[model samples]
Structure formats: structure tokens, C-alpha cells
Target: MATQNLIPLLIILVSAILACVEAQTSDQTSWAKRNETEKEVITTLQFYFHDVVSGPNPTAIRIAQAASTNASSYLFGALWMIDDPLTVGPGPSSKLIGRARGLYGSVGQTDWGLIMALSYVFTDGIYDGSSFSLLGFNPVMKSGREMAVVGGTGLFRLARGYAIANTYQANANGDAIVGYNVTIVTYV
Candidate 1:
């Protein structure tokens, strides 16, 4: 009888230990050190581009609103919780537009306005520490280009880093010609 009770206690203790270990490991995967920085980056890009997204009725007013809201939430989560983000480089507006345009072009002939609008926000969010894959936590760019990386977003799983822009582009219409080029930098 004592042995049976002791066995159960052992199992509980082992499970508790495993849980603690998992918790600590997750912390190691965090990018909390750059949380504030990521938020600033995301906010600057999101504010401007989200407005652009609103202007174009790619879907409908309600749809656009939902997309905007979702992007905002994703951005918040990316900066607040996500560690690594895919990014390009910050550069001249002309160059950024060029890249953004190129990406849309590659997307196989979609609506130009919608493409550009999405491009602006897409690149912006990426450079702002948005993860391609959201561990147990969801990434902000999940709905956008972040998922576009590597056979779409659902495949890539682990992201323990941040991204920075190498270039940027703004269009004459105050839209993006290319947008922002950024790169992923691992979180340490």
C-alpha cells in the first residue's frame, strides 16, 4: 500500500519537474529584451500602412477593418511576445518600393492597389520583429507575408529572433513602390 502511494507521488514529482524544465526552456526562446524596440518599429509601420489598407476596398469595409484589426493584434503580439521576425533592409523609398513591387509582381498578378497596400504593411510588419512561425504563441505576420516565406507560413515552426530592415521604398502616392526590405536576426 505504501509503495503504491509512493509511486503516484513519484509520478507527480517527475511531471512537475518536466513542466518546470519546459517553462525555463520557453524563456530561453524569448526576445523580451527587445520588446520595446520591436513595438516602436511595428507601430510606425502599422499606423501608416494600415491606413493605406483601409483606403483600398480590396474586400469590403468590414473585411478591411477585420484585416486591419487582425494585423494590429498580430503586430502587438509580435513585438510583445514573438522573438524572431523575418526582415529586409531599410533603404531609399525608391528602392523599397521596387522590392515591394517586385514581390507583388511575383504574387502572380493581383490587384495593384491591394498588392501595394498589402506590400507596405507586409514588409513593415516583418521588419518589426514579426515571427514567421508562432510557437505556442501566434505571430503577427501570420496573416500576411510572414507566412509567405518558405512554402507559406504554416510550415515554418520555430522563430527565436528578430528582423531589421536593410532598405525601404515609399511611392509617389505615399504608397510603397517596393516597401521595406528586411532580414531575420536570431534572438539570443
Candidate 2:
């Protein structure tokens, strides 16, 4: 009788152990790597955000492996379609910003984030009267629509709310942008 009771208890213990082990194993993709196209896109986007969000003189590569998530793959792709998609920095300043302003400012990857980041930096990444006026004047008001109209990318549909929130803020005139996610465009 004791042996039979022990057998059942042992089975239960084994089953519980298996459950715990399985829980520890997740089957998600490692998106931070640059082996594939999508991962590379994410890598570039992360660097851009870290760079111009600071200034023309940022001198650090503080972005980590898990910068963005797998879910943001589409936004990264959209960025690739429009921008240079190069990793040109980790130097004294972010070369990604420099190249865009250098030779490809007109037809390069000018995502709403980049535009707003430019506005944000010009304003010293802080919103005062002079700063607010600059961002408000030539901001990305119909940015999503303009991007779609020009290239017809669906990033605007994929990440609209984030774009609006990141790309603009409220002032007496309207919203001001401290920073914007140039990659994500809006539909309506």
C-alpha cells in the first residue's frame, strides 16, 4: 500500500518539475542582432533615437541589445524604405544625422521622427517660447499623410498613435515636439 501511494506522488512531482522547466523556455526571436534585414533596421533606428534626441554633440553609444522589440519590425522596415538605413555613428556625433543633412537630405529617409528630432534638437530638446515657436511653425502636422502620399508606405497605419504623441505637443499655438518617431506615420 505504501509503495503504490509513493508512485503516484512521484509522478505528480515529475509533472510539476516539467511544467516549471517549460515555463522557463520561451521561443521568441532574438531581434537585436543584425544578421537579417529586419534586425538591421531595428539596430539603425535605435541608434538614431539615441543620437539626435541628445544633440549634434552626443558622443556615446549607450543603446543596448534590446533597444526596440520584435513587434516594431514594421516601423523599422518603413524607416529602411525612406531613409539611408546606415549605421554611420558611434563616433563623436551620430553620423546618421550628419549624412542625412549632408548629401541626402532631400530624398533620404526623413521619417517623422527625424524631422521632429531635428526640431527637438534645434530647440535644445526642451520646450520654451523660442523652441516652441520653431517646432510649431514647420512641424510634421500632416506628416503621416505626406509620407504616404509620396511613397505610400503603410507605417502610418501601423504606428499612428505613437507618431502623434511623439511627434507633437500642445502649446498656445498648437503641439510642440520635443522628439518624434519619424518612422511611424498616421492614417487619419
Candidate 3:
């Protein structure tokens, strides 16, 4: 009689534990499904990037370089830390929208290629306080160069996209005005 009673109690305990585990598993699955089913939004933006490598108030400054950097035609192993301005137009005095803050290094031996890791930190309009990260290779001498938008924060959370850059103007001092077109996808 006592064994029978204990068996019922054991069975009830096992069932309760199983139920708890199933509930937890189901809750996690539902959360993932919800995110997966959410709609995605694609947004495109155009802006100008001013990379001021010269003058008194330079935005980009050379931080490090290998000994052979100057001798190499491609500037291999040269790295620069940048806080370049992003604006509405190609001119330096254009209305500021954001900043491209990060670093780029010459990683190519045969070409003028730079490995860029930047954060597009916005400070105006609807995107203020939001920021997206970019990482890719930029061929400086090329007419049109593209980079990947890896991720973001704030309004741009979980963002993925691409950015195209074209040199609008450049001078012998290495200061440049570059135009950018970016397309991004984010969860709605």
C-alpha cells in the first residue's frame, strides 16, 4: 500500500518537472519565432565624408606605420585613426549629419587598399543617437569602392548593409571629400 502511494507521488513529481522544462523550452522557441517573423525594413541614405588629412584641424591622422611604408608605393602597413565628418554635401562647411569614427590601415601590397573599421555615429535628424558599424576593404584609387555594414545600435539595432564611396575631390595634401551612398536592412 505504501509503495503504491510512493509511486504516485514520484510520478507526479516527474510530471511536474517535465512540465516546467517544456514550458521554458516553448517560451524560448516562441521568442525566436517572433523575431524571425517580424518584418524587415530597408533604408538608403546619401551623405558626404570629409577626410581631412592635412591642415591645422585634421580629422584623420597617421597613427602608425611600418618602416617600409614610405618606400612602398601602396603605403603598405600604414594606419590612420580618423574622426572624419559626414555631411549633407561635399563641401567642408556642409551641414553635419554624423561622423565616421574609427581606423583604416593599408593592407594591400600591390594596390592602394585599406582595411577600414568604422562606426557611423549619427547625431542629426531621425537617426540621431543611432550608430552602425562598417568593416571592409577600400581601394583608395578606385572610382567606386564598397564596404560592408556589419551591425549597429540604438535605432539601427541588428543592422546589415553596404556602403559605396566615391571621391568627390582630393588635393595633393591628401585631404579628400568623398560621397557615400548607403543601403541598410533592419528589423521593423
Candidate 4:
């Protein structure tokens, strides 16, 4: 009777040990910390985003108006072409690099919340395009606003960065020509 009980106990002990060994091995294989000597790459990118809202038909407009006041929420889609000449206006050889699409929720007369997605396509790079998301509070009446670059694709697999956006121009209809200064720190 004693030997029979001991046999069951022995089996249980062996099984527990094997299970622990498997778990630890798998955990080690899944994640590894970076070495101290591996330095991160930082890049500064500048671009202009042309948002047209002055024509009889425009790309951006107020989708909803505020219930009590003149404030309105807008949904806009714009293509941010790469201005190779570093000029604010459209150029001849300007290539399409990305698109900025988002909803602008008006909180105040000049204050708005932005939920935007940026998709970038590298025409002459290792891989095509990678996308990322942005959440920010933009004061259209102010000089600039800083937004968070939540995440992105391709070479920007684990991308995280910040963007400084300034209003370069606005027409009578309140359409915007914006400038972006982005500092990206990412690991591929």
C-alpha cells in the first residue's frame, strides 16, 4: 500500500519538473535584450502637407457642426507629397510618400483633437510602405502643436517618434498648408 502511494507521488514530481523546464526554455527563446553597444538611429524629416479647402469642391470640410456654437468637426484626407526641393509648394519631381487621413474633433473655437493615420511608401527602399497612428491636440490658431507617433511598418517596424506641425498657410476658407518636422527613433 505504501509503495503504491509513493509511485503516484513520484510521477507527479517528475511531471512538474518537466513542465517548468519547458516554460523557462520557451521564455528565453522568445525575448532577448539589446546589447549596450547597439546605438539607436535618429533621423530628422521635414515635409509639407497641402490641404485644399478653397474650391467649389474641396478635400476637407466640416462633417458635423456643434450643437450649441459655431464649432464644427471635420473629416479630411490629404496626400503629403514629398517636396524634394524643400519648397512649401508643389514641385515638378515631387513623389508621393504618404497620406494623412483623420478626423478633427473640435473642442473649442481654435482647439481640436486629431486622430490621424499616416501611411508611408518607400519607392526606392528595402520594403514598400509602413503605417503609423497619431493622437494630438492641435490649436489651429497657434504657431505649432506637437503630436505623438504611436507606432508604424517595413523599416519602421517598432517606430515611435514625435512630430511638430505648424500652419504654413491658410486661405480665406480656413484650408491649411501645414509643415511637419518629425524626429523618428525606430528599430527595424
- Residue 108 in model 2: shift from native, Å? 38
Model 3 deviation from the true structure expressed as Cα RMSD, one decimal place: 3.2
Top candidate on lDDT is 3
TM-score of each: 0.22, 0.22, 0.84, 0.66
Query: Which pairs clash in the backbone of model 2?
Result: 82-109, 83-109, 111-182, 112-182, 113-180, 113-181, 113-182, 156-185, 169-175, 169-176
RMSD of each: 14.6, 18.5, 3.2, 5.5
Candidate 2's TM-score: 0.22
Query: Which sequence of candidate numbers ranks them by lDDT, best first?
Result: 3, 4, 1, 2
Clash totals in order: 32, 10, 0, 0
Q: What is candidate 3's TM-score against the reference? A: 0.84
Q: What lDDT tens digits, residue by residue, belong to model 1 across residues 1-188? A: 99999999999999999999999977865746556344221122211111122244321122222323334522221111111112233322322211121111111121111221222223332343232421121121223233222111211123232222211344433323122222322322
Residue 7 in candidate 2, Cα distance off native in Å: 2.7
Q: By TM-score, who's the top model here?
A: 3
Candidate 4 Cα lDDT to native:
0.59
Per-residue lDDT over 1-188 for candidate 2, one digit per residue giving the tens place of the 0 to 100 score = 99999999999999999987776553223332322434212100222322232334432222322334223522222221111111233333444331221110111123222222222122111111111001111223354322211111222222221222223232432123323333323233
lDDT, candidate 1, equals 0.28
- Residue-wise C-alpha lDDT for candidate 4, range 1-188, written one tens digit per residue: 99999999999999999999999987776644443444576666676666665567554555554354442333222222221112234442455555555545544433444444444333333334655555666666666688887766666667688888888777777667778787777763
For residues 62-102, write the lDDT of model 3, one tens digit per residue: 99999999999888999999999999998768999999999
Error of 2 at 3 (Å): 4.9
Number of the candidate with higher TM-score, 1 or 4: 4
- When summed lDDT is taken over every stretch of 10 residues in candidate 3, the lowest stretch is 85-94
